[model samples]
Target: MITNEQITAYNEAAISVLNGSAKNAKSRVKVFRVSQLIAQETIMESVDGLHLPESSRETSAMILMNVCCNKVVRPIDGSCCQPPSAPALTQKLAAGFFGLSIAGCLILHLVHRHGHRRSRPCADVEAGEEKKAAPAASACPSEVVLQSCCKLGLIMAYFYLCDRADLFMKENKFYTHSSFFTPIIYILVLGVFYNENTKETKVLNREQTEEWKGWMQLVILIYHISGASTFLPVYMHIRVLVAAYLFQTGYGHFSYFWIKGDFGIHRVCQVLFRLNFLVVVLCIVMDRPYQFYYFVPLVTVWFLVIYITLALWPQITQKKANGSCFWHLGLLMKLASLLVCICFLAYSQGAFEKIFSLWPLSKCFEMNGNVYEWWFRWRLDRYVVFHGMLFAFIYLALQKRQVLSEGKGEPLLPNKMSNVLLFVSVVSFLTYSVWASSCKTKAECNELHPAVSVVQILAFILIRNIPGYARSVYSSFFAWFGKISLELFICQYHIWLAADTRGILVLIPGNPMLNITVSTFIFVCVAHEISRITNDLAQILIPKESAALWKRLACMAGFFSALLLLSSIRGEHRR
Candidate 1:
């Protein structure tokens, strides 16, 4: 692998070329080619600095990636090209492509149209005029359409693969045979085929300044680990994913470090972080006693510190004034995804309880000190409700400050409609809280927890002012748990199967303390390692485009295998 030091030196060299190359480029292609050349030169310079065993194809592709990124075009006569004036048909098409509801799509269209006008002109005439245009402005509508269509095709192909795998897995579950390995094989095939073409794709190369590099590395590491855990079967993966997500949410508040203030993704992150804080906090408060886990509040403080540090220390938060509308659209998609998550959780909960009594609806209920729990030595529900509220209040205060700032360009208050909706949500939550307080049985309160969860869900939906999506800041584990979250949640129980303790692992072999320590270590390490290997091979061999399909199939296979394995062990023990 090329070293970082080499990359830096090459980048410095490429900068010199970029500074001097503006004089002679005629056609856009030529300019693009020049950029490509600079990128290639930089990569070559870096390659010469390090020894690697990579195939020639890989080296060439990397060089090509540099070339694609470095190219800069002079305008075609009149103005810097703005994506051909977006026709109404194109707007409609964009709406359809994004899977936005008609109303949501219309809202986006209006926002885009309004925002489009305010963008700097592609180019200015030489009558003492200066040109100012964002890089995304230069993108062609045809290119956007092509990419959208390609992504859709990929999704369809993936679903087809999944359906076949699901049917095949019904026969044998351990997944040690070729039929079970089909998806992995398919990914390896596709990765080899498409990895070469990836060089042709011109993904924006955001300048990796030191500050940006540090933050990106940290976030990406968390993302990688969290994603990897999805393939494992550890009970605590969900909780860990949640905690990491909270950390990510906290970090998102400082997005001014790289993106513009109005950047849609930045705003979406703001909303998500808020939502996550509420969920985690409320769960803490309404269910469980304060344990060492209460230190989660310290994250809120850390968030504040980072926000202040970024705002006050400009050196840490540099960004170009103009960036990409693509990023804004991306934000909208992410904001919309919260709805997808809620639906998924609801569906999964229903399916899990229906198929396996172990995951009963009551598993997610509020906890109370009771005789059964005392005898069983297990706490099914641990509430974090108060902590959630505390985090929300802090977030609200920070957001209010942002709104008050003159640089924000718009007032911070939710629109009039949003305010009315907020009022309704507050009323609903209060009424529910009052009703719940009057309840007696632990079962009754436990039953009510899901309902209360719905209220908060609705509130979050209202705040986003978008239907079927979460608007509140949510924990970052959504990204972290993208692949391996399910594995971590389920697989760790087998370690305890030997102890014949209930589904929950208790670490008392001959002695409770030693067993617990050994159990936790074994569980965490085994789960982490398993997830890491599964995800590592998948990451290397499978293109991200096919990851989702493979992940779903792999999970289904893993789940079935676990079920059969456990059943077989039980039978042997009975015999």
Candidate 2:
């Protein structure tokens, strides 16, 4: 719809600004004007027919600029000059650090090898037993370097293949016509079924919880890969799964703290180290903020909150086993207080922002200019964790009182009572599903989520464990995956998927099924390796002895201090 007169004005303005930009930066007014003009959809329709012949060099640049900027957002604050791109400077620094870490490892190996070699040589030529230690001495570094290169090469190859090669590029063509069947089909194919001996099958035991995590994680992965977020029902269900995870985080940690009552610096350090280790590495390597992997931070925050809540008062332990109504009342009061605080924070984003934006804490948690993302995330699952804690307390209390019991072949309640509960649980779950599916928009669904998420979660638990056999059996397939579920969740950000999981990594190319299979094998292997590495590191870092623990903590604190200094330097650089 833009006229020829407008086109001419645009061309002239662009040329002048482009020329002037060499000597001095173009003003926002000029850039905005140019961007605004070219963003018209009609311009593309008329692009081929345009007849204004100008200087070849400027004209070609103009044409390219127009093409790149077409349908792009209008400039605001002169940011249009910088087209969208990855966090280049940060990514480069991450890459540099990655290489440096590898180099440092090689150096350490060489030093150690050299020291060992001095004591035991291939050729004591003075002893004349052999002609050469020279080649043997050379073998360790060369062989080690080659081995290191191969490892580095494999990682670099994945980065290049995923990014530059476009073997698995972000594609929305498939998403435009996405279907509910896609995820369902994926679920059916990745069926959750496995068996184990029934000797130790308590309700919500390790295998049961692992199976829950595994299946939930798998569904989430499928939902993402298939771009099923467009479906309100699918999105709602996924949100519930995430809520369930937070619920487990609350339940599991609260149980540990209350029962073990260790409250030692060492236990806290170990848990934090386990949860944050991969996330911290990813933040540096992927040039993402800590809040970018929001789940871990959410879990970490909740864990600390639970720790403080229990650690502060007259400490109650499982060993303190006697029935104390006063202690129970105290626990309930603590939960109520936490709920109030959660509501207060969730009620006002401004208050949430103000509190988190405080200086030292702000440095760690803040993303970009504010904490709105954190606020949004925090508000979404606000009550789930508390619900988890409440559930844990109730279960533990009942168990303490000999009021409820669970075993391998025993139903949660008496037969008739179990049947009634089963019916109620199934009805509740179905009703919730129906409600979730009927919601027309994300806003409508999310508004009800924090309050009602517990319904579906509790309902699922009842349906899962009310029956003796059902409670006893869990899918070992899912449990295996659940063990590495954290790594899988974090790793999918980079290698298993691409574009931060906007698309799948096409390791086999062309054949989607084959690619998925191959990529999955690699992904699972990688997750397992990361799990092993994390456990190995934890063994060294988190010692049982209190004295050893403090030294490790001090070293970790120093490392974080340096990281904070670097971040501050970067912030100043931006200014």
Candidate 3:
């Protein structure tokens, strides 16, 4: 019915509009294609000289595709694709890290030169006054600082490469179920390599404790690396291992205080620094929440609790308390008060949450908003540590009474008493197994943990006390591992496992065994280096002579000021 001229004009307008849209879409597609090309070229250049395996290259490409094409959904209109944005922050961080590494190298060079010049003067002075001569300084003001800086830079580089070039980043998925062969293999290896202690020692001697921790740590590492947290038995046993660590903490600190009877500022600072230095540094470098590294904070808090309880009570600090009964009563009273406090926290969830979520420390609880997280972690092994302290008290008291075997002498008790102890230990072990097997949920497990943990802890104590077992079962390998267990645990959060312990990175790709071996070797080396650095820092921070109150105040002020500055920078960067 319409005129021919009008219809032709309408058709021409429609064609022009479609042409405009097509042109825009074509330009967008061109931009995306160019960006993709550039990303591929950059990645290829980065790995060109490395001579990576074919599987590794393929994996690397897949990782890059994932990172670059992430969140780019298909358009219903079938329009142009948007290009991926570059990881600008990650690149900037890598640059800053390399710059710091260079600065550290320069500082090391200067320090070495200065040390050489000062050595002659120090030697001359020592020659003049042999009696008053100071000990020679170690080489170059502790290369620990340089080593730590370099390692940090390397870690940052790895992270940046994985993020920017998308080398090893992959979607995290639950691994398929596997047999218990891996864990069994781990146990058999540990047992086969076990070496008994040659000399006579106490039931829970330093070596034995270290060995226990070492074996537990090794098992835990396997569980994590193998992604076996889904397995209930492994998970439950890991919980027990963590509880053992807390037990050791309680026993170690209590024994030290009981023997030395000293809780000075210097001691507190030393312990805090040893536990927290690396963690704090990582928090700044990696932009992670303080609580991301929760174990250190947990131990630090426990240490504070112990210090406050002992330092406040004059009776506990008294070198020569009148009666053994009186000392025992005082100790029990303190522990009872602590138990009451813990109970109050457990019962009052709101109060507990409010306390942990308070300003400053709240930064740590950012990842998990609920106070239940903090409570669950605190309550799981709550009584286990106290059990350790109680055991230590009884052991020491028994030693004082001369009723127990002091060294390698006669049995502490008669044959009947020994038999009874053995029976009790067996019952305790069976009880723990039953309790573990019955747990239906994490909440239920946590609820029963404090009660059931006592059985296993006691069983281990009794077993260790058995004369025959004690003499023929020591593992130097475990003892060595135990010494650096803290480092291994902390360092594993980043390089060893990635994505906040959720996923594993593929370094060698196709060959799983080769990849694991390479990763583990590097991980161990890094952890050992960190251990050395921690020791060096301890020596530097904790002076033999007590620092003056004013000097200590000044140091704290400077430290907090630096931390504030770092926090501000991080906040700005985040924005």
Candidate with maximal lDDT: 2
Q: lDDT tens string, model 1, 293-377?
A: 2233334434443343334422221232223445434433432343354345344545423432332222222124212322111
lDDT of 3 by residue, 133-166 (tens): 4576665544655665666566655544432234
lDDT of 3 at 219: 81
- Candidate 2 lDDT at 520 equals 77
Per-residue error (Å), model 1, residue 300: 33
TM-scores of the candidates in the order shown: 0.24, 0.76, 0.76
List candidate 1 segments past 4 Å from native: 1-412, 415-437, 440-452, 458-485, 496-511, 540-575
Model 2: per-residue lDDT, tens digit, 1-575? 78868877987878777766575455433443434344442345453655332343354566567546732743321111223344545456656765675777777779878987776646566787864344444444344444444354345446445533434533321443334466556565555435665446566888889989988888777776667787788789899999999999999998998888788888888899889987886665555678878888889999998888777776766666457777777778888888898898999788889888886567667788678888888899999999999999888888777766587678888888989998998898889889997998899899999999999999998888778788877778788889988988887766766656655565664587777788778877877876776776676668889887888789988977877777777778878
Query: Which 10-residue window in model 1 sums to the lowest lDDT?
Result: 196-205
> Can you tell me which runs of candidate 3 are displaced by over 4 Å?
1-98, 101-107, 110-137, 140-165, 170-184, 198-200, 315-318, 409-412, 469-473, 548-553, 561-575
TM-score result, candidate 1: 0.24
Tell me how candidate 2 scores on lDDT: 0.74
